[model samples]
Target chain A: MWSRSNTISMIFVALATTLVCLYARGWGYTIVQHIGISTDFTDITISAAIILSGGLAMLCGADLPVVLIIGTLGVFVSLTLAQDALVRYLSLAAVLFSIGVYGMVVSRNAVRVLMSIELMLNAVNINLVAFARYVDPNLIRGQLFAIFILTVAAAEAAVGLAIVLAVYRNMSTVDMERFNLLKW
Target chain B: MGENLTALTAWAQNHSETTAFYILAFLAIPFAYGVLLDRRIIRSGFLLIGVFGAISGVFLLLQAQFLAMAQIMIYAVGITLVVVIALMLTNPRLEHDVNPAIPVAKTSGIVVSILLFVTIYLSLRSEIWPLSPSPVKADNVLQIGTGLLTYYSLPFEFASVLLLVALIGAIMLARAEHRPPSQMEERLDAQEDLSSERNDNVVQV
Candidate 1:
């Protein structure tokens, strides 16, 4: 249920968010300073900009679907651009991990849940590699850890899918809600 | 004002890598969302591949060439394809997309996910990370190989064993149920055997 005008409005909102984040350079840093965390304010700035855009879109009567799309895109773009380069990478990883969490929680299908879990693992891998790149580039301990995670993730996927198959054969349904056999 | 504009333009031009990062992030996050939120599970399976492929590109950007190749090989090409096949085998009739989650559970799920994310984000922003300034050497693959076979050899061996066990377990679990024939089919077999015996007698006669 998306109209052309709504889509246009959403793009406008996203563009507006980009402009704000790009120009409000030290706003993120200031937020971090107040928080007393050595980390940057990239995450908050992006979240605020996207939330602001969404509110603006609603005020302008942008449809719900358009607003959602714009908000997501705005978050995506700002996530990559926030903070310094190394910190920006970490922020992106955080955003991804959050998305994975949302998926794992909300998905009804068991296999979809597994996919979400993989997404979460990949997000962790991103963080590891980012740290490896920016912090310990010489040793690459982070990359090595990432390799181990990859191995573990592969093993987990195999075991998980096998269990899913067994459950499907027994119950004829892969819905997460239907898996209450273990519940007291 | 003119000087500020010029400085901003120059800074933007110098940060071309950031532009690439933005492009890859755009490619990855939406597809990852599709994997979870798409009503059609089959489409989600395909979208998972897209997400992995983009993540592999991100790995390359981070200078983890070996990890990037492995990501593409193991995740993009291997695991996702397996997932898609499993989805097809499990749900051949497309009868799945209809069951919406109860609103209460759905809302709780969203709340929990948001809480977890907020916690992680806050911690990441607040933590003081130990950072090194040295660049990664050119012979990353060699160093990794040496480390894997030497200092990390125990874990490497364990990982292989784990893979072997998982492969065997998956094969055993996914094998078709060993069901016997029904009574009607058994009776039909008997009748066919009797008819064949009588035909043989006639031929002998």
Candidate 2:
């Protein structure tokens, strides 16, 4: 049951990593050379580790112990390998995103599910900011958009939780299975 | 050492491509994991904080100091706090058989979700994102503030009104039920007791 095949997801993640690395190597050589840092080996290693952990989590099912160990190690290693400031930020963001996903899968509560969604949103925000920083330094619109996204997220959380609370009050238990009020 | 540090900062500032590469790679881990993993609340909360920190770093790297600060203050801090608080309020106890009932509409939901994802992906691929040649110099905070106050003022006010309504609704819903007969009977008994005590005091006076 734990080792059900997930070849497609793994391949997709690997392919994405490869494309990202190739792009970085080809277009970012000048910047890397200028910084005088040798990151090719380190970058590949970090990427591979992330892919492995993510793949394992998906295939073997989301066991908290395995996820925590793999995610923590992946985050630490990636952060250590990251030479650029932006890379550091991205590494941190990615770790959070993974943690959030872990929460979403393992959590049984509706509130926890909402929290996980917030985590995922935050991860996206980090990426947007990082990209904005690199691609357009002067234009801070991406950051502005991220703030807007946050406001929307907040409103969503408030409404969602309110609904959950209402449901809980009606039914003594906060169990999702018991929330079959609308079910025919 | 000072010179080297300056050089490093300058190099970071200039290298957009490298910045993009790292940001994407870093973001990919979470994005992939989020989609694949089963939900876990505390882990998700922690992840949100991490993502927020990363985004703030991105803003700083781009030299959008205001944006970075806002991202940290609002999205990272505000949303995370709200979510965590909501989780506490809901108070989910762990149990083995707490899974959501498998809906008969599962097929429809899956089909719709897949279609939506595909549509979004296709649209994203087809569209050419316009890369601005020159970055805008406007302070984003000031612009956002002004926009909210001026042109977007009506919508802002409406949102505030909506929040007030919701708050009122929550209060009404959460309030304890009062049985009319019980309340009236208790009130009558208290009144009779009070009247008898008052008569006794009057006689003593």
Candidate 3:
């Protein structure tokens, strides 16, 4: 009984690891080097290890979706780390943004979806602050925008959670699949 | 204790910004993954708190001290509230151990996110940013406060107004009755048949 599930999970771990490594190597060497900012092989391997951690977790096991999400973000992070200072910050934001997108798409729970959205907003804030650091250090207008984004994100979360609670009251479950009252 | 504290400060001073940046980003990636990968959704919510904390440290490293503090104060407390709401919404009776996996959505989510990440990364690398030669001053909070009062005064007031609106709107939405007033009236009118339909929405007196 354990062997069957274990075989499938092992296959998933292998696939995720292979996919993440191929992308890191394929992009890590050529395009990243051509750009003239890519780091050494050591860093690339470190990023690959980050992706493999997810693969390991899955082999150790919750399911496939979680592993894929981790792999995708890992690829984004490791590949982006090839660049230097400002670009690294920008790429990290991009990695977080990608994870947020994956979560938004895969999550079946309504609250989880909103949480993914919050992740996406925070990623944007990172970009804004990074730009403030690089582009306009003296005036710091990017920080101002980030602060505004923070305010709006808080407001959005408050309103969104209230809506979720309202939905929960109408229908006892918070599962997105079960929300069929308005479904045509 | 004083000697150890001074030694620690000297050690930190020896490392450059790049070193600090790598350290914090490395510290953060796993927790960010944990936010979505955990089996329990509530657990993921708590994981998000870790992500926020690490990112706030990155903000501090970047010289945006005020943003870092604001991030900690706002997101830490705000996410905890989100987790609490998730707890309230979860039905104890419906908790389960496992599910038959859905593969199609899983594949699509991965595909779309990778495509989007590639697009974002390409755009970021392709463009050349116009970085200023002037270094950021040490007193970031002072600069930010001055800028807020002088340059961004209008938007600052608007954000406060927005927060006020959200506070009132959220309470209104949560307290809102789903069924029409007439259905509610009919339900109240037929007190004899009250036991048939359960009224969870309280009719305010």
lDDT, model 1, position A163: 88
Error of 2 at B147 (Å): 2.5
lDDT of 2 by residue, A1-184 (tens): 4232344444444554544444333543454455665646444444445555555554555443344334444434433343544445555555555556555544446666676677677766776765565555464545655655655666666677777777765664566556788999
> Which parts of model 3 have CA positions greater than 4 angstroms off?
A1-78, B1-16, B92-95, B98-103, B176-205
* DockQ of the candidate models in sequence: 0.51, 0.20, 0.50
The reply for model 2, stretches above 4 Å from the true place, is: A1-108, A116-149, B1-17, B20-28, B31-40, B59-67, B95-122, B173-205
lDDT of 2 at B29: 49
How does chain B score by TM in each prediction? Answer: 0.80, 0.55, 0.72
- Rank order by TM-score, top first? 1, 3, 2
TM-score of 3: 0.74
lDDT, candidate 2, at A24:
38
What is the Cα-based lDDT of residue B43 in candidate 2? Answer: 53
lDDT of 1 by residue, A1-184 (tens): 7776667575767566655565356566666567675555555555666667666666666654445445666654554454567776777787778778777777778888889899999999999999889898887888888999998899889888888999987776888878987989
Q: Least accurate stretch of 10 residues (summed lDDT) in model 1 chain A?
A: A75-84
- Count of clashes in candidate 1: 0
Error of 3 at A76 (Å): 4.3
lDDT of 2 by residue, B58-158 (tens): 55555567766877787667766766665566543232233432345333433343344334433433445544456545565676577667766786777
Query: What is the descending lDDT order?
Result: 1, 3, 2
